[model samples]
Target: MRNARFLWELISYRPASASCRTLFMLACYGERIVFGLAIQAFFNTLPQHTQMTPELFVLFLPWLIAIAVRLIVVNFGTIGAVRFEFSAQALLQHNLFKHILQRPGFQALPDSVGNTISSFRDDTAIVVELLSHLGETCALIIYTSVVFIILLRVNVLITLLVFLPLCCIVVLARQAQKGLEKYRRASRTATSNVTGAIGEIFGAVQAIQVAGAEQHVVAHFHTLNAQRRASMVKDRMLSGALDALFGNVGDIGTALILVLAALSLTAGQIRPGDLVIFLTYLAIVSDFFTDIGSLLAQQTQARISFERMTNVIHGMPDHQLVAHHALHIHDKVNEESAPPAVPQPVVVPLQQLVVRDLCYRYPETGRGIAGINICIQGGTLTVITGRIGAGKTTLLHTLLGLVTADAGEITWNERPVADAAAFFIPQRSAYTAQVPHLFSDTLRENILLGLPEHEHTNDLSTAIHTAVLDHDIAALEHGLDTRIGVRGVKLSGGQIQRVAAARMLVRQPALIVCDDLSSALDIETEQLLWDRLRTSRTQTCIAISHRRSVLQRADQIIVLKQGQVEAAGSLEQLLTTSQEMQRIWQGSE
Candidate 1:
């Protein structure tokens, strides 16, 4: 009884679909009651010479009716509950995904993508097992208990004798649960490690191949798999031991009960029919104890899976700020209209960006830039240059309010952008990612991304020309209407870069931030792109680049070293005055 209470507490603690759970529990009890009564009726009806009264007939009829009703109800209820669980899993997966994409480039990564996929596919499936298996376990327990109660009424002494051994087995089984749970938890961790390692290897496949480290990676993967397998083996061994121990003890108890019955029958103390019924009930009682062991093991497994899922759901960074701002955007746009049916913005933009003593730390690693300050004036092409991993990417992220700056106040114009302002083009830009995620989508529709039914006339021809994509696109059978394949794989690297550039250019945002995107282009192409970019009016551009050709066009060149600014000046000034710049130029060229 205490074990049952604990199980119920576990279920209720993290209840999924309360109404469904309640119905499932009720259905379980009904099933057990119906089955117990049916078994009892079969015993009573045997040996036709025994007196069969009207009350017994009434009892027998109801038991048959109840079992039939329970079968239908339980089957339908389980199906509905499972369907609901799957639907909820799908919704959660979708929301987690969309949330990550909305994050700034700083927080985006290859690992986050894999984690989301695993959570949806692997994690959710485990949770479903918890629901279905746990439900069935509860039903089995109730059915077994009902039979045991009937056995007790038939012969109190024999009933107590059987239950005493069953009680000992239950106590021993519960003791084994703690060890099983530990192994189960280890198994889960090992599995996660294997998954995480595989995700990392796949994500960095290019780097691994370049470094010629396939053997090393495979060896590491094997070790992770070995650890996971070892944990599973141990868990299974412990579970098997519990099962064997319980089965043996129950067998002995059954033998003892049978001997006592035979002795009683020999002495003419109990009828043959009654002794036969006692043995049948004894079997049911033994099977129930075994089921209880199965239930406990399953519950432990569910607990492990639930704990893993809960960690992820709770580990995600808060989306509250984004939600608030999205609401703010709607509010501001709507306030200008009569009746105020839409949301209104309470803040306006002056368009200058100022960073005062900015600092940023990677959330998990606690390693990043600190004590940085810069001002980005409107209407100039500002370039940030740095050695690899020198916090160039971090700075761009800091400006966009992506990674939370540890100690910095970034204000737009004079007002802080705890409101709204900039659009950041990450280091990889839209070129490498699924942005403007091409569909069977028209070029116009893809670019506009559902702006409005009336707002569908945005032509990319001029922007395409500016981005040097005119010639390439014109060769296509449908020109701008040509379908770009998934991730734009059908396009060359340069062509995809140009299309992405064109997409960003067409937006004409107040601030355009680019990161290391010009590294791939030839000198002439880079120069041509810059000439076109120079024509934009009243928009600030900040680009991170290593190429001298790209840097020549910058109004201000900020050089970073070891997460600090080595110098900030024009290209000519940097060449003459910055030692790090001189070294980099001499070495690279």
Candidate 2:
């Protein structure tokens, strides 16, 4: 019932479109009644009216007019269906993306990438496919009722005989429901498994080769394909059988009506023209049963699609999947006109930021930051340094709300932050992760990803210079316009880091957070990077680094060990007082 309601909500998403589609489609189907009556009249008057008689011509005229009318009705009905399909599809995709973006940045998605793709592409489409048929189904219902009344007036026994097939069709459809739903679900699952395995194979090609598992991988792929083939065959076979069953049942009913009409004709109980109309209307009525069967089958598949979509979204309410939202189908404004101005974000200067009792633990490993504390005043460099696996990256991720904290309090200039992920955005706090992500686009676009080039043109230049990427990019043939291939794989490791740093710096956030920004740079480049950053005196910075140049220049240095802050002070003080700090400092040498 809940799934049915969701489908109804989608169909009626744009009421205006739904109404036009139904009205126009009815006009199209209503033509069938006009033509049916005209044919019956012509046959009945054949003995009374000679060739080219005015009476028969009168009936012929309406049939001709209906032909022209059908042309227009089908055209408009097609328009309505097309518009509704696109709008409903846009709404579902919009909601899916919105829900996906709302999750914590550090949390992995519930489904594999291929499965999510299938949910977005296949699952959403099947639901809308059911919606597309609804207009015709409504028109057919009205057409069938009118035909039923016409036939009942002609002969009571024949009317029941003609519609008996409809009952059989309904029973068969009910019987096929379990198989239809089960096979559809199995087919979709098998398809998802095959697609997921393909994605995994692509991502792990190097590992597979290193492990000499090529044959094993091939065997696994073959297995998945076999499963998909078997499931699809069953699904299609069952669906086809239902269609054939409806057709054969309708044919048997038609034969019975013809035989009964012949007997009545022999007894002079019915006119020959009455049999013509019966056959004519019987074809249309037969269509109603076939369509009803198809609709019931599609309903079963649509329910399965909805269930899969809900799973992709981590069990979000089914209504959310089809929730009504604005679908900007077309641009209302003229292209020659100026585009609307974008509003800039508000920026507040940071006096100091404080964190107390911040804690988070990995459920799998139970080794994450715990009860961490820190304070940063404006215009100072605060470097967080630690050895490998010391929770340096985790601390940064936890505080920034990329990962949810188990317990914490964050104060930004005396204001408490309720949501770190939402609050720590561009112009407030900009962070560069240790392993940065880049798209297969030009370096210029990647650097100004969030910041508009025209608005932040100067910020672009300053950030490039600050991150020491200006020299590297200038060395390239196309400079910043050069396309960095997928994930910046074409660039050296150091260049990728610098491009990411420039991306973070361009926003000119009040607080700068970086995780091992210098991990890939050489000593001289690292030195130059710090020198450029120190030149900016008003912004606070928290970074992960173990370089002596960074250690010596730090306004405060924090050393982490085993998920806790072991010591925190200036480089000189930490070297003198803390054994853990001394070991870390010596280890750097």
Candidate number achieving the greatest TM-score relative to the actual structure: 2
Candidate 2 segments exceeding 4 Å error: 49-52, 197-220, 312-318, 332-342, 361-367, 385-390, 546-553, 571-589
Q: What is the lDDT of residue 320 in candidate 2?
A: 85
Clashing pairs in 2: none
lDDT of 1 by residue, 1-589 (tens): 4334433433443355423644665565665555555556655465553676675556567667766776776677766666555544444445445555555544544344445455657766665555556666656566566667766677777778778878887887898888999998888777778878877886567679999999999999999899999999998899889889767765777788788888877887765656666665555567667867877787787666544444444436433111211112123444364243223233323256777777887878776777777877777878888777788887777767666566777776676656222333321122223222344455555554443434323435556777787777778889767777655656766676677677666654556677666565677787888888788656677888777776777888888887777898888898999998787666657
In angstroms, give how far residue 406 of model 1 lies from its true place. Answer: 0.6
Q: Local distance difference test, per candidate?
A: 0.65, 0.85
Reference-based lDDT, residue 194, model 1: 81
TM-score: model 1 vs. ground truth: 0.77
Q: After superposition, how far is residue 68 of candidate 2 from its true place, in Å?
A: 2.6
Listed in order, each prediction's TM-score against the native is 0.77, 0.90
**What lDDT tens digits, residue by residue, belong to model 2 across residues 1-589?**
9887887788778877766667777887778888888888888888786566676778778888888888887788778778887888788888888888876677736778888888888878887788877777888899989988988888888889768757866786888889888998999999999999998897667679999999999999999999999999999999999989777766776798889999999998888778988888878688888888888988988888877778766746767887887666765757455465555457788888899999999988999999899898988999998889999999999999988899989998899999998888888889988889898999999999845688889999999999998778889989989999877867988999999999999988889999888989999998999899889888889999887888888999988999999999999999999998898889888
Candidate 2, residue 141: how far the Cα is off, in Å: 1.3
